[model samples]
Target chain A: MIEKIFVGSKKYWFWVFSLMALVGIGLCFYLEQFQYGLGITGMSRDVSWGLYIGQFTFFVGVAASAVMVVLPYYLHNHKAFGRITILGEFLAIASVVVCLLFILVDLGQPARFLNIILYPSPNSVMFWDMIALNGYLFLNLLIGWTNLSAEYKGLSHPAWLKPFIYISIPWAISIHTVTAFIYAGLPGRHFWLTAIMAARFLASAFSSGPALLVLLALIMRRFSKFDPGKEAIFGLSKIITYAMIANVFFLGLELFTCFYSGIPAHCHSFEYLYGGGRLTMIMWLSALLACLSLILLINPKTRNNTGWLTLSCCSVFASLWIEKGFGLVVGGFIPNPLGKITEYWPSLPEVFIALGVWAIGLLILTGLYKIAAEVKSQESNAA
Target chain B: MNRRDFLKIAGVGMVSTIFEPVLPYEIKPSKKRLALLIDITKPFDIKACLDACNKAHNIPEIEDPKHKIKWIWPERFSDVFSEQIDMPKEITIPVLCNHCENPPCVRVCPTKATFKRKDGIVMMDYHRCIGCRFCMAACPYGARSFNWIDPKPFIKGSNPKFPTRTKGVVEKCNFCAERLDKRESPACVEPSNGSLIFGYLSEMKDLISNRYCLRRKPDLGTSPSVYYLI
Candidate 1:
């Protein structure tokens, strides 16, 4: 089993080494954070949640977006996803792992996390979120491993696996939907307190998630044996376009409602994001980049260019992060009940800790993909 | 549905239906009642509330270094402003645990830690609260306060008698549950004497109507135990 993972030209050793180094740095940074307290991070009374929670919110969506591929490839029989669907399931597992870790880091007492379960609030969306994340993690792991193992033996999967894949499709959507509920359920938080929130989350998740997967597919082709065909890429690209269009459309509706209704509660958060206030620059930059990403993806020409495609994928991801992580979470607190804008910035230790967690997630993704690549290579060689 | 059936179907619970806040809590003209009176027109004296609370509910008095918010009001509109006036010709709405017949907090509490009293006051078992803040988020009145830090000693050495809450959990006013049990009035109203009224909410609602004139978020249907002398 160990030899299978090390099937050596020793190329992967470099990735493993680099990951190890990052792990060491991450540990040092996290230790400093623990010594001080969350105060080590930029978060304060106003921005109680910083990059860790923000990134957690963003990545959970990415994890959920795997449903796009999972649903269509397996249940709907979209032939375009035939060769690459397992990639999406594995990606879901990796992304959920990251999402869970980010939440762990954000907690004031990571150890007390089980208390959430012990003292679970079923009515609270958080309880449901925990349920979804754990459920999705188990479901995807089982499905990905079972299906891939079947692929290795070159045999059909048993009938039972089919239903699990179908269940995962909706479960993926639920994970992010429940995440959006974490925000939407807040009463006075203007930006998050929208009925449109869940729809907007799905829109963004569907778009950015598949876009990231597209880039991953591109990387695999460039670096290894798993070359997902253009038809598959194009199908995913179309799905991405549809979701992006919806995401942008939902954002537009938010703009119109906040402006037209002219309610301060609704408009203030928008203003905070778009330049009516301190976060204007970030809001503008995020909006511009995100908008441009969609525009680029929309056009058949630029969307097809690998370089441009990668750039746009990053732009969309960053834009969504700015919207959810920064504006949505922090803006809600400004003009706190006293309506004061107490600013927030994550400390260096916080940043490092966050980076460490991201590095760990990436390492997990890298390891899993390496094993998959090897297995695929062996299968093809046998054939 | 029967209690047994509801719990079984819900597949989860806080079994104590001890005091379900529905509405029209027992109209006994004689039973002692509890509530808080707020002049919502001005910045609420969260500090005053903390200062007044000697050892509210047996929970240790946490001296908020930042005085981290015990209460606040957005002060929405003209009617709200008018409603808060001293109203020698005006109002003073008592608050603290609406102990509503339909208390939103009790409905939403994940852990059955918060429940309505036989007296119809919403109460929390501090011991059971894990501080998830979901109850805080669910509460519409902004009545909840998270234990963002250790409970500060009210005095330099007062036996540190209040509950010391760890960070990450939430807390709020409990109508001085400890005081009520000891056969005393809530500390806030002790100063009000007759200026603040406590009794069966039904009778008190009538008193506010006949005497000072009463009103609340009538539309919300919370059936708040609190009533204002408008």
Candidate 2:
């Protein structure tokens, strides 16, 4: 079954080699970062976290999106999702790997990384995040591999996996929640010091995570014999629509609270993000696209059209990426602790490092998806 | 199951309970705990104190201020207190670690590397720090600094008494815990001519009782041990 990945078309080989090239390039820069210290990056004392942590946050969301498919299929017994459930699990495994790698590169002392586990401060949100992320990664690997092996042998999934499958649902929510707590519990950063932060994180995860999955499904249908099925895709779109609306609403609530109360610390970060130069344009553009996507997705006529569905999902993914990935971490640092503002822009090496991590994730996704697609194709041909 | 073994087990349990380390911040200051009081109303040269601290701690003289490792540094009062608009003469207040009763840095540190000592000094164990910089973000006073580059090259005439910090570790003024152990005042305080008071806050309560002293960002409920007398 594993040999199917090795036996592929020239186009498939091209994609695999391209991702490998990116991973190789990224590894070189990461080795340089390891040698020279994090000083090579654009991060200063003022902006301690830069592109690496931001990417970590984004990928955590991608990992959590797997539950969107898993819950409906396993809990509610939605049969359409049975075809694509493995895809969601495999996507999760890849995203979690990316999340862990981003953290690895971002560390100032990568060698001492295990101290977080060695002397685990249970009180720290980061400790809990480590547990949640590692747990989720293992759960997905176990479930994904076990189920795929069963499929290969033409047998039912083991009965024991059911308990673990049920546990994965809340474990998904816990991972994103712990990630949000990393920012929310901080004292000085007013932008992140909100109770709604976790709620906002989960909402955005639901929308952006599932939206990416939807886009991947569309691409799969075009390129392979495997389809996630119309019912499954439409079901996912409905989930994404509600979650995006909730995410937007949560952001509005944050804005209203910060402005209405007019606390200087709380209001300043928003001013820096939305009331200032290029950042303002980025924020407004994300808002506009989010609204446009929601409208497109909500209308049955537009949503039924493959063109609109793809466009809408892409828009939602982009909008949230800008809002959460690009803006959120950077905004929290502006109007820094002492009311001094220092801007941050990622260096070229940092960008490559991030791109490299993304390529690695896509490589894993491609390998996993190829195996699953091959198995499905074999079943269809036999039938 | 034997009586001697049962007694030994009970004794070990009781002794362990008695000796288990408690967080210093949680325990009320029964013994005299040290604190620093800085009088900013009078003009004083800050350069001398900054230099003394740099030399004492083996802090690097990074040419770029952006990457400089600051233990104790001067900050404009106007910037520190953004909401206040009163015409109290322009001033520079020396800011360092607050060694808070409820330190957000100590709380957020996953390895317990940054912790408050029994005498109320917030200290860092560099060997244990993974350099996640959660402490930097957690600190409201902008007190902590990270070793972004190798500090050894820039350190001019390294102090033999104090070990230099390596790259990829968070560091700050440990209230001169090493100096305190030697019965010497902090390097910065040694030069402040009587403007800087270093003593147990409980013992110095009579001295600073009526003075108009305030800690930075006191509203955050961190209960800073360092105070500024304006």
Candidate 3:
């Protein structure tokens, strides 16, 4: 199946080469970081985690979004999703891979990475996150592989896959919930201490993850024999619309509480993010894009048109990328624990390393999608 | 004859070595749980105390305040305890790790690298830390400092007793755990000349009871052992 990925159009090879080029550049930067310690990056004592951990948080949501496909198909028996569930599972695998790579690159002592496993502390949220993420990865691999191979073999999915599928539904929710707990459980961080944190994480993950998946489906329709069905795209749009709405509602709730309480600590991060700080432009842009996306998606007439739907999905993804990936982590540390302000911007090496991780994820996603497309094409031709 | 003679020599050597007993390494526990009492009410010279801590800990004198590492230093009373009422102006309160009974850093550390000792002193095992800096975020006091760059080059006249931290690991005031092992008071305590009290909390209860003492954000429930006498 993987061999078929190699026999592709020149554009496929070019894409592969471009990702390879990025990986090469990233490796060079990573080597420099390794030699000089984490000093090469833009992080300081004030803002301990910068771009890498922020990306780690974002992709955890992306990895967890496979639930949108999994729940409807497995639980509700939505036949429309049967064709594209494999794409969601593969996206999860790629996103989880990127999430893990982000963590690895962010580690100051990469050599001692195994200490997390060797001396596991049940008390730390990071410990549980490690378990949830790796467990989700394993479940996806097993479920996706067995089901796909069964389809390729032209047989019904094995009965044993039933329990695994059921387990994965909750497993997907747990991964992002635990990731949220990683920040939310800390006492000093006013920005992440909210009770609705896990809820917001899930809502944003569902919107962002599926938006990317939908865009990928549109891309697949253009390049491959797989149509992913008109109904399947519409089904996913409905999920994105509701989740994005819930996500925005959650943001509003946070703002109302922070401002109404008049507590300086509670209001500080929000003010820094939107009140003429470094992230002000990105935060406002995210708000504008999300509002635009919501307006487009909520209207049934606009959503029906594939062109409008595609644009809406892209907007939601970009909006969440700014909200979660760029501002969320950095904002939490602003007016740091001691009431001192320190700003952070990624260095060139940091940017390269992050790009490299994304390129690696995309490369894996491309390969996996290639195999899935090949199998789908064969099944259609045989029919 | 040659084989018998070698065998006899080897057997005697083994017997002789077995009779030579090895000496036991004694591990004595330090005096009862230690605490620090900073008497902010007194007019103590803070510079000497800060110098003593810097000298004792081998802390680097990095000129850039952003990257500078502090083990113990003077902070303004208004800056740290803004909520306090009737506190005197122009008084400097020394700030260091609270070494809390319930340490947030110890709880969040994934590798158990930062741990609280039996005597209620929070200690860091540098070798075990993966440099995640999660502990830094968990600490409410802003007590911890990370070596953002190699801390060695900036350090002047390094102390051989205390090991200089490498870049990436977190370090803070250990309450001079090494000094305690040798049955000496913390470096800052000695320099303060009765202004800073270092003793078992049980032993110093009378002194603390007489003073209007406060710990930073006692409501947060970290149960910090370091108390400031106002």
lDDT of each: 0.67, 0.88, 0.88
> What class would a CAPRI assessor give candidate 3's docking?
acceptable
Each prediction's RMSD to truth = 5.7, 2.3, 8.1
Measure candidate 1: CA RMSD: 5.7
Tens-digit lDDT string for candidate 3 (A154-219): 887999899999999999999999999888877768899889999999999999999999999999
Taking chain B only, the TM-score of every model is 0.63, 0.88, 0.84
Error of 3 at A205 (Å): 0.6
lDDT of 1 by residue, B35-90 (tens): 44443334344434444663443344444323243522223333333323333434
| TM-score per model over all chains | 0.82, 0.96, 0.93
Which regions of candidate 3 are displaced past 4 Å? B1-32, B86-90
Q: How would you encode candidate 1's per-residue C-alpha lDDT over A1-383 as one tens digit per residue?
A: 22455654566677777877887787898776554445456655444566777788888888898888877877788988976787787788888888888777766555566755666556556667889999999998888888778877787667899889888988988998898888787644566778899999899889878888888888988888867888888788888888988998998998899999997657766666565676778878888987899789889998887788788878887787787666766676654433456566566777777777878877777777776777777777887
Q: In angstroms, how far off is B110's CA in candidate 1?
A: 4.3
Regarding DockQ, does 1 or 2 come out ahead? Answer: 2
In CAPRI terms, model 2 is classed as medium
TM-score, ranked from best to worst:
2, 3, 1
Model 2 off-target regions past 4 Å? B1-31
